[model samples]
Target: MNQENRAGQWSRARQVASPNQDARPHGEVSLLLLHAISLPPGQFSGDAIEALFTNRLDPNEHPFFAEIDHLRVSAHLLIRRDGECIQFVDSDQRAWHAGRSYWWDSALNAWRSKLNDFSVGIELEGDDCTPFTKAQYTSLVDAVGWLMARYPALTPQRITSHAKVAPLRKTDPGPAFDWAYFRQRLSQAAFKQ
Candidate 1:
């Protein structure tokens, strides 16, 4: 779970190999969904997030773990508060992050569902109440740049939040997330790269 180098994966990230993933339906990645998560609520920087994504979380470890230990979800990448990057599912594959989600598709001129078929998921090591670290944002900006270079269709405009896609069930990367700051950083990174 600590692979340093691998094919079809980001070079800078540590690979954890989550099983909650599969091949993309049509080999297209056009969206980037940012999500916020923390083990046991507002806590930060633990193996619990990785354990949960890899289906190894012990329900007895924590009350919150018991509630979500049944989930089989994974994100393509996770950016930790310390700015460490972890690759769970390969970006070319479909991570089970977006469940029963939909978004407006301008090309199709309609609301589209099944976002996992064509979207890359990134989980920020944070909660709705805590402000994400500057390190996390830096790592995220770098990761997004790397992903953009690989997936031409994944523009900054295409990047969104889990809350936007699943309003009724989720509100992550929430009010504490500064969209303006992240966007400015992303814009600056784009120019530098």
Candidate 2:
């Protein structure tokens, strides 16, 4: 891992940064939001999704993007189907992918936390029913390990699927993502460390 290059935080090639980001709130990087996306909902293997994050999506280029043309969003990282990891936002920064989301925090009532401010968002290339490839899982584990190593405050409990955080509005890293398998992977990684 190239410690100097934050881009090396993941195991794949790095892409252009998204402008839709800001500083983490209260310097609290305590949560990890897992998500999934495909350019045309179910299609894969295209640069359209990457372009969208960088604010360069050509609406007319694809009919599926037409509806979301006016919307702007971004995540900290995206793990392609083949497990190619791309970083759109830095760990120290906040990504704008999560909107109107909340997570449990015993100290606060109706705790509303800005996704960008309190958590790191990672988008996988898949749909609701699609099973994530083994490579993607391996890559996700590695990426999360890197982040946890860099930020001592991050932990497995902090990691959660998009559905868990925004149950009413979003669902990704879906049901097929087998939380137990990944949780075991994380525990093994932590043990190894």
Candidate 3:
């Protein structure tokens, strides 16, 4: 798959613009945040994810939908279980994925709050209890490497999980995600380029 991100859009990804995005404050894109999500909490391969991002989700479709359909949220990219990548928001823009989160930037020696202002969010088609697919991991590594290349401030250490940033309200890309394996594969992917 082509990994080049041109003007905040990946060459190989399907674009689906989401209204839940806006200009990034200070035009900063320094952090990469990983998140896990599945419509109805566990199901996959449905239009619910896209619909939610685009503000078209039907609350009557499911009970859980009723609770979250009103939320305005989106991510920069989503890697499906089959490794199909979809881009909902431009990387240069602020997607409403991370809410009330904070990250400590060692390079700047400061604590950054409201991560959406400086971070790119990627959502994997998964939940907290289930392990993500190999295809997803491969796509994620490639995507992360591409982002790191484009954003000089991003690095392996700067890439973190949603749970870590929003410990009080979120616990996704949770324990099921293998951090060591992802780091190793990401290194290999980066090395290849």
Candidate 2: Cα lDDT at 33: 88
Instruction: Give all TM-scores, in the order shown.
Output: 0.95, 0.90, 0.95
Give the top-scoring candidate (lDDT): 1
Candidate 2 residues 11-123, lDDT tens each? 45476688888777687777888998998888999898888888888889888788887778898889999988889887778889778888886444457666678788889
Arrange candidates, best lDDT first: 1, 3, 2
Query: What TM value does model 3 have?
Result: 0.95
Q: What is the C-alpha local distance difference test score of each model?
A: 0.92, 0.81, 0.90
Which is better, 1 or 2, measured by TM-score? 1
TM-score of candidate 1 to 2 decimals: 0.95
Off by over 4 Å in 1: 1-6
Please report how far candidate 2 places residue 45 from its true position, in Å.
0.8
Cα lDDT of model 1 by residue, 104-128, tens digit: 9887789989999999999999999
> For candidate 3, lDDT tens digit of each residue in 62-88?
999999977999999999999999999
Evaluation by lDDT, superior candidate among 1 and 3:
1
